[model samples]
Target: MKHTPYYLNKPDNILPKGLTNSVFRSSDPLAYHQSLKNYTVTPLLKLNELAKYFGVKKIFVKDESYRFGLNAFKGLGASFAISKILEKDPDIETFCSATDGNHGRAVAWSAKLFGKKSRIFVPKDTTRARILAIENEGAVVEKVDADYDETCEFAKEMSRKNGWQLVQDTASAHYAEIPAYIMAGYFTHFMELEDSIHTLPKPKIDIVFLQAGVGSWPAAAAWYYLNRYGVNRPKIVLVEPIEAAGILASFKKGKRTKPEGNFKTIMAGLNCGIPSLTAWDILKDSTDAAMAIEDSFTKQAIRELYYPTGDDKRIISGESGAGGLAGFIALMTDPRFRNLKEALNITAESRVLFYSTEGDTDPENFKNIIRKKK
Candidate 1:
C-alpha cells in the first residue's frame, strides 16, 4: 500500500499581489505576541549533517516546540486572533472552534489566558491525549461524529446557537476577518527570522517547505516570504498528506477545490479535505509548487528527526509537523520525484528552510512510531 508522492509546479512566476495588504506589514503581531507571558523566540537549528547527507549546503529548521511550552506552533494564530477580537469586543465571554488537535488546544489556551470560556469540538478520530490537553486549557471539549469539515460546521452551528465567537482559521464568505487575523499572527515567527537569519552562514534561503492542513499556516508563510523578498523570494513548496491533499488538488484546478477522499491519515492535524478561501487566494499565485507525501514518509521523517545524524540536534516532530521534511526527503531519495527536485532547482549548493511545527503531542503514539522498525 505504498502511495507515491505527487508534485505540481506552477507555470507562471508571478509574486503574490494579495500579500501586499497593510495587515501583513502591521506591527500588531509582534506587539501582541510579546505581551504574552513567557514570550521567547523559538530556536532555529542548523542541521549541517542532514544538509550534507542530502547534498545541500545548509538546512535550517525553525523548531516551534518551545512555543509557549504548548509543543506546537498553533498558539501564534489562536492567541493573536482572540486578542484582536477582545480589543474590539471586551464583553465577549465565550470563544469556540473545531480542530483536529493543535489549533483547538491553542484556542482553548488563549481563551483561558483571556479569562473567557471556550467550547471546542473535534472529529471522532481525535486522540484521547489531545482531548485531555484541550480540557486542561479550561475548555469544554466535545467529540463530533464526523470529519474535520463536518465538525467545523457543527461547531459553527453550536456557536451560532450559544452566542459563542467562532475563532476558526478556515474562512468562508462572511468569516474572513478572524481567519485573516489568525494568518497575520503567524507573521511574528517569520519576522523573528528576518533578524536572526542575517547571522547564518547562508543568509539567503533558496527554498522553503511549509506543511499545510487547511492551508492557513503555509499561506501565511508564503505571503510573508513573497512580500518580504519581493522578486528574490525563495521558492515556496506546500506539502500535505497524500490522503488529504486539498491545497495540491486546488492548485491543479486553478481554483479552490475540496479533495475527494476519506481524509484519513496518521498526521491528525493535516487530515483536511478543503482549503480555506483566504489561503487559496494567496497560495494560488504565491507558491512555487505543491507536493503531497504518503503517511509512511512522514513516519520516516519523524524517526529521522528524533534520531539525528552526526552532530545534528534532535527535533521531536509529530506526524503533521514532519510533513514538509517528509516531502523534501521523498523528493531527494525517491527516483520517482527526480523531475520535481530538478524543477525546484534543489542542489548541493541550495539552502533550504523548514518549520518543525509541533512536538510529540501524542506521547504514546509517538513512542510506538519511533519504536517500529521498517
Candidate 2:
C-alpha cells in the first residue's frame, strides 16, 4: 500500500468560543512540574539555516530530547499522572500502561520514583533497547503479539484484573480522568515554550506543526495556545504517519474514528491506530489543518536533522521525533502540497514552531541509520 502525503483544512468555526474557560485553566501544572527535582525547561532552539531554506521568517524547534532525562516528552505527562493518582491512593501498590516505547518507560520511571510496582506492556515488535529501558526502571515488561492498540486493551484488562491503575494516555468515555491528567501534564512543555517565545523580541510564532499519535500531546498544545493567545493563537497542523493516521481519518469523517489494518511504521511512537476521545474533543474544533505523510519522508527528515545543511545545528531526532519537521518540509518543498502551504498562509513572514519529541530512543537503530548514510 503506497501512501501519499495528504492535508485537509478544518472548518472556520470548528472550535468553541472562549477557550479560556476550559477546565484545564483552573490550576497551573507548570508550578508543580517545576518544583520537581531536576526539572528544567527544555531548550527552544532557533533553526536559522532551516528557516532560510524554508523561506520562513523564523523557525523554532522545541527539543524534547533531554526532557526529564527520558530522551522524550512522555515523562512530563507520565510523572504528573502518576503523582495525581498517588495523591488519591497513597497506598496504591501497582501501576501499569502500554506503549511502543517512550510512554511505558515513563510510567515505569514514575512508578519507581513513587516506590510502587509497575507492569509495562509493549507490542511484540517493540525494540529491545526500549524494553531494556523499561526493565531497567524495575518494571516488568510484557511483549504482546498484537499491535499497539491491542496491547493497550490487553494492558487495560491486566490492570483491571490486578486492581492496578492504568496510565494509558488515550482516553475513552468511561476512562477519561487519567488521560486528562496525562494531557494536563503535557502543559509543562507548552508552558515552557510559551515563556521562551514571550522572551523573544519578536515573539511571532504564526503556526505550529504538531505530530500526533493518540492526539494527547497536540491537544494539550492546542489547549494552551488557544487559551493563551485566543484569536491570535498559532495555526495548528496535526501530522501523522500515513499508516496510522487515526486523527486524520477522524477529521475526514467529521468524527472520532480509528485507522484500520495493522499499523506498522518506522516512526514507532506515532503508530497509534486509535484517537483518544478526550483529545479529539479538544482538537476537533481547535486544529487548523491535519496531514498524513509517507514514512520515507520521516527518514529523510531524520537524515536532514542528523546532517544539517550550512551552519544549522545537528539534531538527533528519532523516527517519531522528526515527523513534524518532515511534514513542514513537505508542505514547503513539494509542489503537490503547495495548496496546503498556501491554505495555512505559510509565507516568508510566517514564523513556525515544531517539536523534536525524542532523541535517539532506540540507540542501535539510530546508529544503523546514521551509519548507513555514510
**By TM-score, who's the top model here?**
1
lDDT of 2 by residue, 8-61 (tens): 655453444432234365556788788888799988888888888778888888
Instruction: Write candidate 1's Cα lDDT for 264-319 as tens digits.
Output: 78999889868998888888878888878778889998988888888999999998
Candidate 2, position 301, lDDT: 78
C-alpha-based local distance difference test score of model 1? 0.86
Residue-pair clashes per candidate: 0, 1
Off by over 4 Å in 2: 1-4, 11-23, 198-203, 372-374
Relative to the unseen true structure, what is the C-alpha lDDT of residue 199 in candidate 1, on a scale of 0 to 100? 33
RMSD to the true structure for each prediction, in A, is 2.3, 2.5
Q: What is the lDDT of residue 262 in candidate 1?
A: 66
Clashing pairs in 1: none
